[model samples]
Target: MPEITYRDAVIRGIAQEMARDNDVVFLGEDVAKAGGVFKATVGLYEQFGPLRVRDTPISEQAILGAAMGAAMTGLKPIAEIMFSDFFAVCFDYIANEFPKSRYMSNGQTKCPLVVRTGNGAGSRFGAQHSQSVENWCMMIPGLKVVAPSSPVDVIGLLAAAVRDPDPVIFLEHKSLYATKGEVPDGEIVDRLGTAKIVRPGRDATILALALMVPRAVEAAERLKAEHGIDCEVIDVRSLVPLDTQTILASVAKTHRLFTVEENPRLCGWGAEIVSIVADEAFYDLDGPPVRITTPHIPLPAADILEDMVLPTAERIVETVRRSLQS
Candidate 1:
């Protein structure tokens, strides 16, 4: 097994898919010669060449539009929207075009494309650049949403997304780019709509995704050590075809549930999960499900304010402890 940073895994994932499939192509701003704004795509340009790996102009609309065209025309294209928030600019493609293409055409057409973006806070990029907008894509009926939390997942899920026969939103957390993890050698491909129980416990279950995953795990460890409140921490790797079975089973065993989300409290993905639990697994819960989330407001630029606004491990510990005690 080799340990690698999440950033390098991005490069390897794209390279692996592009190498295996000639139909796979990548395009985005600064992704070619500059290796991306975050330097995550270094060596791709030289390896794949200009035709396969390209740099696009500064327009999210043009980026996704071209990607949709390429996908519909039998090319598997991976398009990058520099920031996930910019999806608002190309809502038509995401909301109407790419997703509905195959269905609208009565399965006569297929749009197999991937929209990857830098998502989530922790870079102090302020409100516009720091949103965890997986919730936005998850709401659409035809889209498959994926937010990978580790280096291995970044590779495995990216491979899976590239090969799928439909549109996929692959969210890469900006804050997690530097984190390192162990990845087994070989061609790694993972299934979509699966939740991983990173730390298993019997008292409660804490659901989180992307950057919130590590925070929830830390909080779970602290709670067990200090308060004897063991918690099962589940990394919700995929949100669209959500693994509700895993979530419900965890809640059934633990009899308690809590969600830690980086998205704002209003309409966050956790709200949907809580609703599902309440509707289907309400009797299994010993207490009301709790949601620990960022306040419903635009993110602040100041480091102190950003720290206070995002859901922290300390906040998770405090919230879980207080809720259980009450």
Candidate 2:
């Protein structure tokens, strides 16, 4: 019933889980005393104390390496990567170690590790800081990838991620950190592998993720108000165990599909969503599937360059309008 920021919702989720379980611990650069770079973990250090909420060195490999070890042994560790782009620094450890532990150990070991990272562009954080690479984690076999668009989702998905018995890439989009939404009262943990229909319509279906979810809904409203093109907007919260059923069901009703994301056009998450729709619900679509995404280039720091490269509501409206006409 009360509106809260996405950042606060995340902190609540972590704190609730940590209070509920002693095995839960948090460690990352600036996560304790500094309270996280984005302030997502503020006030946690004092409440949980230094042992549970720790600040680690700025080494992704070392941080994740320690988290993997802790998770496998007895604890559920939440390791923050600061920026999603830094995951590359520890990809070898993730690829060769964390994800493979369960199978390699023949189910003798479980990796209940959750890596929280700030994701997406639109903050003008430049090429190095701005990237929507959740798709990379989705490609991995043993990892679960989930991105939250609203405050409710941040709390629900993060809570679920903390309790899951495997590695989870929990993405918090930088653009949506300040975004506010009404979160339900009490403990609510939305299951992984589920999608939500943010807006219902009849003309077309717009499938979006993370930061693009709000943009898609905005585009849908504009399309309806100005152009009379109603649209169904879907928030694909969980990427790894994608909710293909929800996507197909929406496509069946609207008869058109469009995928939106901040990631690059080539091989991005949007591409994967559209491909699945095309492959599974081929006959249900009235037009060819469309993908609205950023250009296949580094995100620029300049506002104008970023705007031109990024997907906008105007672009989404136009894309959906053109799809209907064709």
Report per-prediction Cα RMSD to one decimal. Answer: 0.7, 1.0
* lDDT of candidate model 2 versus the reference: 0.91
Best by lDDT: 1
What is the C-alpha local distance difference test score of each model?
A: 0.94, 0.91
Model 2 worst lDDT window (10 residues): 92-101
Q: By summed lDDT, which 10 consecutive residues of candidate 1 come out lowest?
A: 101-110
lDDT of 2 at 174: 93
lDDT of 1 by residue, 1-326 (tens): 79999999999999999999999999999999999998889999999999999999998889999999999888999999998999999999999998888788899878899999999999988999999898888889999999999999999999999999889999999999999999998899998899999999999999999999999999999999999999999999999879999999999999999999999998899999999999999999999999999999999988999999999999999999998889
Model 2 residue runs over 4 Å out of place are none
lDDT of 2 by residue, 1-326 (tens): 89999999989999989988999999999999988989999999999998999998888999999999999889999999999999889998667787887898898888998999999998998999999988778878899999999999998899899999989999999989899999988887889999999999999989999889999999999999998999999999999788999989999999988989888878888788888887888999878888888988989999889989889999999888877876
